[model samples]
Target chain A: MSCIIERLAIVGVGLIGGSFARALRQAGAVRHVVGIGRSRANLEHALSQGIVDEISFNATEGVAGAQLVFISIPVCSISAMVGAIAPSLAPGCIVTDGGSVKAEIVRECEKLIPEGCHFVGGHPIAGTENSGASASFATLYQGKRCILTPTERTDREAYETVARLWRVAGANVCSMDPERHDRILAEISHLPHAVAYALVHAVGTADAEGENVLSYSAGGFRDFTRIASSDPVMWRDIALMNRRALLASIDGFSASLAELRRRIDSGDSPGLAEFFTIAKQFRDGIL
Target chain B: MSCIIERLAIVGVGLIGGSFARALRQAGAVRHVVGIGRSRANLEHALSQGIVDEISFNATEGVAGAQLVFISIPVCSISAMVGAIAPSLAPGCIVTDGGSVKAEIVRECEKLIPEGCHFVGGHPIAGTENSGASASFATLYQGKRCILTPTERTDREAYETVARLWRVAGANVCSMDPERHDRILAEISHLPHAVAYALVHAVGTADAEGENVLSYSAGGFRDFTRIASSDPVMWRDIALMNRRALLASIDGFSASLAELRRRIDSGDSPGLAEFFTIAKQFRDGIL
Candidate 1:
C-alpha cells in the first residue's frame, strides 16, 4: 500500500483537500503532495503547516505530473477547475473528487477529461463542523465510508488506484453506479442537511413579533444549527446539483413529520413510543 | 453553602437525582443524603457506590426527618409520589422537583400537599444521553440554568431554600410563573424532542417497506437520532402534560418547513440563501 498514488495533487486546499494532503503524508501513501487553491494566504498557510510538499496557486501547475488528482473545491466550482487542469493532467492520471454529490461531477468529467485519462467520481462520507486548511487533520477520514461511482467504460486500474488511495486515508471504499450513488446519498446525507437548514430557518424567523427564543434552544436545535452552519456555498451547490433526489427526500421526510404531528394530536401514546423505539434501535445499529 | 439542607432526600435515584446527590455532597450543602426509589436494585447500587449516605426502599420513610425532598421521578408519576410522601414529610418541609414541564406538577402539589409543607416546581435544564445513577457526576449542573416556579401562596423561605439548593448544585437559578415556564420550555426543550422523535420515526418505519438506509445517515441525521434515543416514557409524559405549548411549537415549525419547500421548488435561490444565512447568523449569536 506504499505510495499507491505516486504523486498526488489536490486541486483545492480547503478542509477536505488539506486533510487529504495531511493524511496522505502522515500515512506515507505518496512521494509528493501539491495543493492548489484561490488564496495566497491559504497556500502559504498550508505550506507552513506541512499540508503539502509544494504549493501552486495555479490549477494547471498543481496537476502537472501527478498520478492522482483530487478536485476538492465547492461542487459549483468543480467544472471550472476540471477545465483548467484538463490539458495538463498526465496521460494515465486518475482523477476523482471529494464532493457530496457524484452525478454532476461524473457527467462534467465525462465531457472534460481527455480520452486516455481516467475519471472516477468519489465522495468520502466524513467531515466536521469546521472548514479550511488549518482545521484539517490526518485522522479526518479514519473509519469512514468512501463511495466511488465508476461507469462500465471507466478503467478498472483507475478505479483500483482511487480506491486504494482512500484506503490509505483510512476509508472503506464501496463502488456503486452514479445514479444509485446520488439517490442513496440524497436519503442519507443531502436530505439531512436540507432538513437541518430548514429547521434552523423555522426556528430563527419563528414568531417575528415575539422574543424569538431560538437564542435559548440548547438541546436538539443547537445540533440542527451546527449542521446548518456548514459552508453555505458548498451546501447550496449540493442541493441544486442533486435536486431531483434531494426533493424526493424532502417529500419522504415531510410525510413522516406530518404523520407524527397527527399521532401527537390524536394522543396516540403507544404509536409514538413505537416510533421512537424503532428509530432508537436503527441508530444503535449504526457506528 | 455548608449544610443548607441538613438531611436531603432524593426519590427516584436515577441520573438526575444521583447527579443532584453528588453535586450537593460535593458542594457540602447537605450533611447527609438519603436515596429512595421503587427499584431496590437501584437503591442498593446507589448506596454501594457511595452516591448517598444511606438508602431507603420506602418513599415515606426516606423523607421522614429530611428538611428537603426532591421528586425526581418521570413526569407522569410525580403526582402519585407527592401523594405517597405527603403524610410522612416533616413539618415545614420544602418539596421541589426535576420535571421538564412545571405547570401540571405545581397544580398537583396544590391539590395534594400537607397543610404545613411547601411545594415549589423546578426544572434543571441540563443532562446527557446516558441515564442511571452510575452515569451521574458532581459537575452535571455546572453553568446550566435551573427554573423555579413558586405559587403565590408558596412560602418565601421555602422558595429561597430550593433556589439556594440549586445554586449549590452548580446551576444558575431563574424564577418564572408556572404557566409562562411551560410555554417557554415547550419551544426550547419539548418541541425539539418531538421533532427528533418524529424524524427518527419517519426514517425507521420507512425501512420496513423499502431498503431504508438509516445506516447511511452519517451527518445531520445522527444528531436527530441521538436526541431521539432519550427514554420513551419520559418524553411521552412531557409531550402529554405540556400538550398546548408543544402543539403551538409544532405548528410554528411546520409553517417554517413549508415555506422552505415552497422556496426550493420555485427555484428561489436567493430566497433560500437569505433564509440560510439568517438562520446561520441567529444560531451563531446563540452559541
Candidate 2:
C-alpha cells in the first residue's frame, strides 16, 4: 500500500502510540512518524527503537505541518493535548485519539478544534498490561476492533482517511455515537477491571494472619486476577473519566451478585444451579 | 515404580476418577483398576480406553476386595457412596474422595467408616472446564497439589498409604484440617467462580435489546469469565456444601466493590489509583 500521509505526528508515544507507529510503518501507510512526549529519555528510546522517525519534546512544534496527528495518551490528558496542539496544526490536518473513554474527549476536544481541521474520537480495543515503547510491536492491532466516534459535524473525508489508516494496520473499524461507545465500554472493559481489582483486594486483605492465601491460587484465580495487574494510573483515570457509566455498571453487577448471594444464603440449590447454567450458556457464546 | 496397590476401585468414572486411574496405571502404581458408575456407556468407554482394567455397575461389588477406593463425585453424593460401600469393603481398605468441599464429607463419612477401614478426605487442586471419561488424561495430576484433610481419629498407616498413592502419581501432597481447607478454598477458588458467574450474568442480562454485547468482549473479559463456563451441577453442590465460608467471601468482596463504587461516584481519582496500585501489587505477588 502507498503512504497515506506525508507526515504523522504521534503525541504521547507509549504502548498505544508506539504500536500504531510501528504498525503504520510496517504497512507503508505513513512516510514519517514524529513522536512527542514529556520524557526526553522515552522519546530518545522510541527514536532509537525505530518506532518513530523523529522525536520532539514540544507538542505544538511537533504537530506543525503534519497532515495526520494521533493523540495517544491517558483519558485525562487528551483534552489538554488537543488544546495545546490546536493552534499549531495545519488547516487540513486530521486529528484522532486513542483514548479508552470517548464521550469526554469528544465533547472537550470538538469545541477546541481549529477551523478546517478535523477531530474524530477513536479507541483501539487492543493492549496489554505492559506499557512503554519497548513493549510495542507491529502486529498489536491485527484482527482487533477499532471504534471511531464520528459526529454529524465530522469531516467525511477525514473520517474515511482515519478509517483507512486503521484498516491498513489490520484493524476492523466501526463507528458509533460517543455516548454509546462509553456506555458499552463501561460494561465490557471498565466493569471487568473494577471487579478484578476488588477481587484481589478482598482476597489479599482477608489474610489477617499473613497466610499468603494467594500462594494456593490455582489457574482460575490467576486468570481472573490477571487484569488487576494492569496500569494503576491509567485505570484510575478511566474510572474517573467515565464515572457515571462505570457507576451504573457497578450497580448492575452488584444487583446480580446480590441475587446470587441471596440464593446461596437461602440454600436454594436449584436456583443457584439455574443461575450457573445460564451463566455458562452466556459464557460459552462469548467467542 | 512397581504396582503400589494390588487392586484399586474408582467409584465414579468421570474426569477426576478416570484421570487418577490413568495416572496410576501409567505409573504402574495399581495392578488392577475397577471402574464403577451409573452410566454404563461411560464405564464401557473407560474400559475401552484402557483407563480401567474392569468395569462394574455395582459400587459395593466393585469395591468388595479392593485395597484402595477412590470416590470421585459431586460433594453432596459422597456420603451416600460411603454408606453403600461401607458394608462390603474388606478390612484395612484405604478409602478417599476427590471432593471440592471437605468438612461435610469428613464429618459425615467418618461415622460410617467400617471398623478396620480408613476414610481420608482429599481434594486435588487441578481440573478443567471439560469433564467425563473422554477428557481424562494421564498428566492431569502431574505437578498439581493434592490436599488431604485428616482428623485425630484418622489411621496413621492409612493416611501414609493415600499420600503415597498421590505422590506416586506425581502430585505434591499436603495435609490440613477439614474446616481450614474449606475456608481457604472458599476464598481462592469458590469466590472467584461466584464472581465470574455474576459478571457474566450481569453483562448477559443487560443486553435488553439482544445486542449480543459479549461478542465484543476482549481478552480481559474472556479470561475473567473463563470459570463461568464450569459445570453448573458441580458448582451448585460446592456452593451449598461450603455455604458459610463462601458467604463470608462474598461479603468481603461486596465491601471492597462498594468502596470502589463510592470512590468512583465521588470522582476520587487518587483514591481509585491507590486502590488499583495495591491490587496490582497483591496480584503480582501471587506467584
Instruction: Write candidate 2's Cα lDDT for A1-287 as tens digits.
Output: 88899999999889999999999999889999999999988899999999999999999999999999999888899999999899999989999999999998999988999999999889999988888888888898999999999998899999999999998888999999999888888989999999999999999998755655778888778988999998899999999999998998899999999999999999998999999999999999975
**Docking quality band of candidate 2, CAPRI definitions:** high
lDDT of candidate 2 over B37-133, digit per residue (tens): 9998899999999999999999999998999999998999999999989999999998999999999899999998999999999999999888889
In model 1, the runs with Cα more than 4 Å from the true position are A207-212, A219-221, B209-212, B219-221
Report, in order, each candidate's fnat. 0.50, 0.88
Q: Which consecutive 10 residues in model 1 chain B have the weakest lDDT in total?
A: B203-212
Model 1 residue A165 distance off true place after TM-score fit, in angstroms? 1.0
Docking quality (DockQ) of candidate 1? 0.55
Among these predictions, the greatest lDDT belongs to 2
